[model samples]
Target chain A: MIDVLYFAWLRERIGAPKEAVESQAATVADLVEELKSHSEAHALAFSDMTSVRVAVDQELTDMSAPIKGAREVAFFPPMTGG
Target chain B: MGVRVQSAPFDMGAEVQAFTKAATGAGAIVTFSGVVRDEGGTLASMEIEHYPGMTEKALEAIRQDAMARWSLTDALVIHRFGPLKPGEQIMMVATASRHRADAFQAAEFLMDYLKSRAPFWKKERGADGASWVAAKDADEDALKRW
Candidate 1:
């Protein structure tokens, strides 16, 4: 099981902060594609890839980054942290 | 290194002191603090929201990135959430290095990344009521220059 986290407006759009999902994704992009098919909310939240950012195992990474054996994956809007 | 995502206000002097005290063989410390602004007199208050776990993780990644890119010994980042008043400190970054240039550049880079990449949302409460602040093209452009 991989823990998926959402933040900022993504959380608002998805209506949850986090969830656990079982996946066979080999890469971050694969996981995103899986998520896009889960439900309408996921589709809407991820419709615009340009507005979203992904992190795998707590590290910011590109969508092509591998996610096999990963423990966590997070999606959110472009950071406005500092 | 220190990373905090909290709703409480932070003291700049105390945070800087902590960073310096935690560092060894550090000669220069650069600190940057972002404050809430009224922004054209339309905003009355601001509500900052963030993904709790992912927020900290993203910041740690940014800190690590800065460390790898610069000859820095230590770094600190603190970001606040929830409702905030104008002039309040919203976020801060401090980097320590042997030379001034690395500290300064790394701190700026960290800020740029945080602004353009981190996942925090801001809602401006004004005379017109509250609304989500739209992501600006300038912010995306700023990140591209890096």
Candidate 2:
């Protein structure tokens, strides 16, 4: 099982800030696809992949990045800091 | 020495003063502050959200990179998350170096990295409604200069 996190509108749309799920998915893309199937809210939040970015284990990475044993995975829109 | 992520507002004057005193041998200091903007004149406030753990980590890495690249005496970053009014300071970056060139360049570099790399997200609330701020291509492109 791995922890999944959401932020900003993604959190609002998903109606959750974090959760856990057991999945055999290899890449972040695969995990996201599996998550979308879990709920319409998930599907809506992830409907457009371009609108979201993924980070595995607190490091920014592409969707194809592996998540075999990551402790945490986060999804959110691009940052607007500084 | 590194980054600080907090919801409480900070005093830019006091922060810069403290950093200057502690920089020791630094010949120059540069500081920058980002404030919430209300471009349309209707923005009531902004809500900033960030990953609790990753926010500190990512910002620290950026701070380390800047200090190493410029041989700075010290570097600091403070970012606030939560609701803030227009014109209120949202964040600050400070750098001290032996030379003005190094301090200025490092400060700008830190800002560029923080804009796109950090885990913080901003949503603008206005009279009409609230909307998430979109990341600009220019921000990502700014990194290429380094």
Candidate 3:
């Protein structure tokens, strides 16, 4: 199981911060597609890929990056922290 | 080395004192603080929202990236969430290095990355009501500089 995290408005819309999921996704984009199919809240939270960013194992990454053997994946909006 | 996400206002003097006190071989410490601003008194207050777990992790990642790219000895990132009034401290970053250049560059890089890469969303509350701040294209362009 891979742990998935959501942040900011994505968390507010999805109603949770983190979860564990079983996935057959090979890349971040594929995993996102699987998540989008899970529920309407998930779909709404991930509606625009351009507005979202992904990280694998705590490093910023592109959606096409592979997710094989990854322990954690996080999704968040453009960062406003500084 | 400290990463904090709190709603309470932070004291820059006290924080800098504490950070410098722990310094050993570090020769320079560069610090940056961001504050809520109102241009021409257009904005009244800002409400910042963040995802608890994911927000922390994202900041940590940014911190690590800064460390890896620069010859910095240590770093600290403090960001505030919740409702904040104008002139309130929004965020602060401190970086230490053996020389001034590394410390300065790392600190600025951290701020740029934090502004464009982190997952906190801001909503400005004004007399007209509340509205979500759109992600600025300039912020995206700023990240490319590093």
Candidate 4:
């Protein structure tokens, strides 16, 4: 089980902050592809790849990042903090 | 180095005082505070959401990076989550070094990294509605200079 988290608008659009997903995806992209097929909300939130950012196990990384043993994954828009 | 992620409001003056007290033999100290700006009185409030565990880790990593790259005697970062009213301080970063250049540069670097690298996301609610603040292209470009 992997804890998938959504933040900001992603959270609002997806209608939850976090959820548990049981998947065998190899990479973050694979996980995203799996998530995108989950529902319309998932499809809409993950629609524009350019606007979305991903972090595996709380470390900022790219879409190709491996999530083999990762416990958590987060999807969100680019950060606006300063 | 120290990092704090909280929902409570913080006093910049007291924070600086405490940081200065802990920083010994520092020739320069610089601090930057970010406030919620309600442009044209439209913004009602800003809701800051952050990944609880990752927020601290990211802040600490950035603080450590500054400490490693500079001659900083000490460094501190404080970021707040939850709803904040206009004019309220959102977060602050402080750096102490043996020279003004290091202090100044580190402070700016911290601010730049905190802008895009951190996990905090902001949603601004104005008179009409609310929207998530998008990351500016300039913010990403600014990181290349460092």
What ranges in model 2 sit over 4 Å off? none
| lDDT to native, each model | 0.86, 0.93, 0.86, 0.93
DockQ of each: 0.50, 0.90, 0.49, 0.91
Chain A vs native chain A, TM-score per candidate: 0.96, 0.97, 0.97, 0.98
lDDT of 4 at B59: 90
- Candidate 3 displacement at residue A20 in angstroms: 7.8
The residue-by-residue lDDT of candidate 2 on A26-64, one tens digit each, is 999999999999999999999999989999999999999
| Model 3 root mean square deviation, Cα atoms | 3.3
Higher-TM-score candidate of 1 and 4 = 4
CAPRI quality band, candidate 2: high
Docking class of 4: high
Q: 1 or 2, which is superior by DockQ?
A: 2
Candidate 4 has a DockQ of: 0.91
What are the candidates' C-alpha RMSDs?
3.1, 1.0, 3.3, 0.9
Report the candidate with higher DockQ, 1 versus 4.
Answer: 4
> Any runs in candidate 1 off by more than 4 Å, and if so which?
A22-26, B18-27, B71-73, B140-146
lDDT of 1 at B49: 84
Please tell me how candidate 3 rates in CAPRI terms.
Answer: medium
Point out where model 4 deviates above 4 Å: none
Q: What is the lDDT of residue B84 in candidate 4?
A: 99
